[model samples]
Target: MTVSKEQIAAFYSTDTLAGDRMAGIDGLRHTGIATFMRCPHRTALKDVDIGILGVPYDGGLTTRTGARHGPREVRNQSSLIRRINVATGARPFEAARIADLGDVAFTEVFSPATALPEIEAHVRAITQGGVLPLLVGGDHSISYPSLRAVTENGAKPCALIHVDSHTDTWPVFQGSKFHHGSPFRLAVEDGLIDPKRTVQIGIRGGQNITDGLDYSRDSGMRVMMIEEFDDVGWKQAAAVAREVVGNEPVYLSFDIDALDPVFAPGTGTPEPGGITMREAQRFLRELQGLEFVGGDIVEVSPPFDSAGVTALNAATLLFEMLCLMTD
Candidate 1:
C-alpha cells in the first residue's frame, strides 16, 4: 500500500501553538527557560550522573571583576546547544542522567572565604548524591574550593588536567592566598590533588617571575608550555596526559584564557599566542576514555565577551567536558 503525502506530513504536526505540551521533534529550542542543553532543571540531585552548577562570585579575579556575571550570561546563551556530539557520535543526554542545578548564590559583594565555602557545600551535596559536578565557574579560584568539596570526603586526591595560559600555581599573590592565581597551590597544600598525576597544558605568556612554573615543576606536575605543545602536537600531548593521569579519578579544569585572545577574548587573562578553539576541541576530544570524575570551564567574563564568543567558547567547551564525562 502507498502512504499518502498527508499521512507522512501528519507525523510532524503540533496539536497546539501554546508550546506547552510539545516534546521530541515538535519542541522548540528557545521556547523555555534555558538550562544546560535544555535538560530539565531539578532542585534535587537524586539519581543523576552529571549535575551542572554555576559559581557566580568573582572576588578572586585579580584583573577584571566581570566573571561574576559569567554564569548568568552563559546560561542565557546556552539556549543554542543541542545534545549530541556530532564529531564523535556521542549522545551525552542519552548516555547519562543529566540536570542543571542552577547557580550557587553568594553575598552581594564577593568574598572568597564566604563564597568558597558555600560553593564547596553545594558541590558536596551533588557528590554526596553520587552525581558528577559539571561546574561553570566565577573564576579559576572556584576550582580550588570545588576540588576541596569533591576530595574532602575522604576520597584520595584526584589527578588534575588544567588547561590555561597561566600556571595558577603561585603559593600566594602579594599578601593574599585565596585569589584565582593560587587555587592549585592551595589544592596541592591541602593534598586535594596528586601533583605527580597532574598535567597542566597550554601555559603561555610572560609572568613577572617564574616562581609559579618552578613550583608546579617541583610539585611534580607535567607542565607543557605553548611552544612545547605546538611542537609535540595534540596527540602526543594527550598521550602524555593520559599516561600521567592514568586510571585515576580526573578533574578537568579549563580556563578560557588558554585560547588566544582572538578566539576567546572575554577571559580576564588571555595571552596572545595560544591554542585555537578547534585545537582545544580536538585536544579535549582526544582524551575520551579517561575517568573524569568532575570538571569545570572557568574565567568566562561575559562583560568582556564581544560577539558572545567567549561565553560560546565556554558553552562549547562545557559540551566537550560533557562528552568526556558521558564517555
Candidate 2:
C-alpha cells in the first residue's frame, strides 16, 4: 500500500508540525514597553506572548482625556493586518528585527517629569543595540524622550517629521513644560533635534494662535498647515519634507488626531476636517527613500473608540512607517 508522490507529500506536510504555537515572553518583541506596563492584562492579550508591547500611559496629555490605553488596542488590531510586503516580500519584523522590548519603567504613576527620562533611557538602550524603536504612545510627549535617546551619545542631530493636528510648539501649558503639546519645543530647546531641518505636517485646529505661529517661525521649524496640503498636494509636501530633512536621519511622529475625528474619534483631542487616511498614506509613502531612524504612532484612546477604527488606523500607519524604514 504505497502512497503516490502527491499523497505522500500531503501526508508529510500535514503530519509535520509548524513552528512553536505557544506564546511567551521569549517570543514577544518590545516596542511599546511603556504601554504594556500600564495595563498588563490588556498587554497580555495584545503583546506578552504575541511580540508586541503596549505603553498605555498618557501623562503628557493636555486634554487629560485618558489615551494611555492606545498601545494595547492598536497592537491587538494591527496584528490581524500583518503580511509580507508584496513588492519587497519582507515581513516588517523580519526586515527590521523589531522586538517588543516592553515599556519604559515609570517611577511616578502620572508624572511626565519622571516618565520622560525613563522613556529616554529605554529608547537609548534600544537605539544603542542598533535596533529601531517603534514607540506606541502615552502622548506626543514621548517623542521628546525618544528623540533625546536617538541623539544622545553625541549622535548627529536628526531631522523631525511630525504629522499632527497641532504644531506642538507651545512653550508651556498648565504650568508644565513637559506636556504633550510641548515635546517639539523641548526637543528643540535641548538641541537634541535639528530645528532647521524639521517639518510639521497636518497642522490645524484653533491652537495655532498668534503665539504658536510666532514660535513656529522663530524656531525655524517648517509648518504645513492641513489647508496648505490640500492646495499643494501630498507630492509637494513630501518633496518639502525630503528637502528639509535631506540625507540626515529623520524621526517620524504620527498623532492619530491628524486624521478627521470621523476616522479617529478616539484621540484625546479630536480635530475635524483633518487629513483622510488616503492622504496620510500618500504623504507617508513619499518618504520611501529618506533615512528614517525611529518613529511612533500615538494618541489612540480605546475608551472613546466605538469600533476600534482609530486603533486599526494607528496600527496600519505604524506598519507603514516600519515599511518606510526598510527602504
Candidate 3:
C-alpha cells in the first residue's frame, strides 16, 4: 500500500530527534496495528530507507515448534519501544527513513526447500529497491535465505557477525541439509558469506558430537565461546568482531538463544551459561559504526513465556541493531 505524505506526517513526533516515529509520548503505543514500534505499515519501499520485514515460518525447527508465532508477538511487544535511545542518544528514527514492510507471505510454510527461496525472493525485492531489510525471523534458518538475498546469491559475499549459543555449522540434520542448525554451513558452502570474515560469539552448549564446533573452527571463523566472552567482557568481544569484519559489508544474525535461559527462555533451543541481557545489550551497543547491510533477531518463541520477556528483549535488541544500521 502507498504510504501517503499525510499518513507520514501524522506519525511525526514533537521531539526533533524522534523524526517520523509513530510511537512517542503523544501516540498510544498499545493502540494501532502492531507494526514494528507502530511504524506505518507499507509493502512498497517508495520513501523508505530501512524496511522491517517478518518471516513467520518455523518448519526448519528440529527442537521446539513455536517460533512461527515469533513475528506477531514481537510486533506486539515492539510497540513498547520509543523513538530515541536513552543511553546512546542515537535517534534511529531521525537517522533514516524506516517503515514496517509487513511479513513475507508464504505459499507453502511446511518445508524449507520451497519456503526458504520464497523468503530470498521477498528480501531480494527489498534490497533491489535500495532499501536495507531488517528482518524478524521464524527461526535461525531464515538467515540463510536472507543472506542469500542480501548478497545477491553469493555474487557479492559479505562478512557475518553471528551471535548464538550454538555454532550452527553442522553439515545436516535427519537427512535435511536446510535445517536451522546448518545455515552457516550452507552459507559458507554456497559462498553467501566469507568464512574467514565470519565471527560466531556466545557459543557454549553441550554436544552429542562436536562436528559443528569442529567445522566452525576448521572453517577459520573466529569462535568466541561464552567462557572467553566472560573473561574478556563485552567490549573486548565487540572489538574482536569489529576487527574481524573490518570495513567489509556485514550481516548480523542474533539468535535469542545467545542469552541465558534466565533472560530468554522462549527459544526453541535454550543453552545455560549464556550471555546476560545487560551484556548482550552492551555488546550490540558497542557495534555502532559497522557497515551493516542488514540484520536479524531470530528464534524468539512466545509460547514458552507467558510473560513475554523474550519478545521484549528481542524488540530492544532489534532497536539496537537498527541503530547500527543508521549513518
Best-matching candidate per lDDT: 3
What tens-digit string does per-residue lDDT give for candidate 3 at 1-327? 699888777656333222134544437777666788777787878889999999898888999889989999999999899888988998888888888888999998777889999999999999999999999988899999999999999999999999999999987789999988989999999999998899999998887759999998999999999999999999999999999998899999999999999989999999999999999989999988888889889999999865999999999999989888885
Candidates by TM-score, descending order: 3, 1, 2
Give residue 134's error in model 1 in angstroms: 0.8
Ranking 1 against 2 by TM-score, winner: 1
Query: How well does candidate 1 match the true structure, expressed as C-alpha RMSD?
Result: 4.6
List TM-scores for all candidates, in order. 0.90, 0.82, 0.93
| Candidate 3, residue 152: how far the Cα is off, in Å | 0.8
Candidate 1 ranges with C-alpha deviation above 4 Å? 1-27, 107-109, 153-155
- Shift of residue 213 alpha carbon in model 3, Å: 0.7
Off by over 4 Å in 2: 1-53, 86-90, 153-155
Error of model 1, residue 206, in angstroms: 1.9
User: Candidate 3: deviation at residue 2, Å?
Assistant: 32
**lDDT: worst 10-residue window of model 1:** 17-26
Best by TM-score: 3
Candidate 3's clash total is: 0
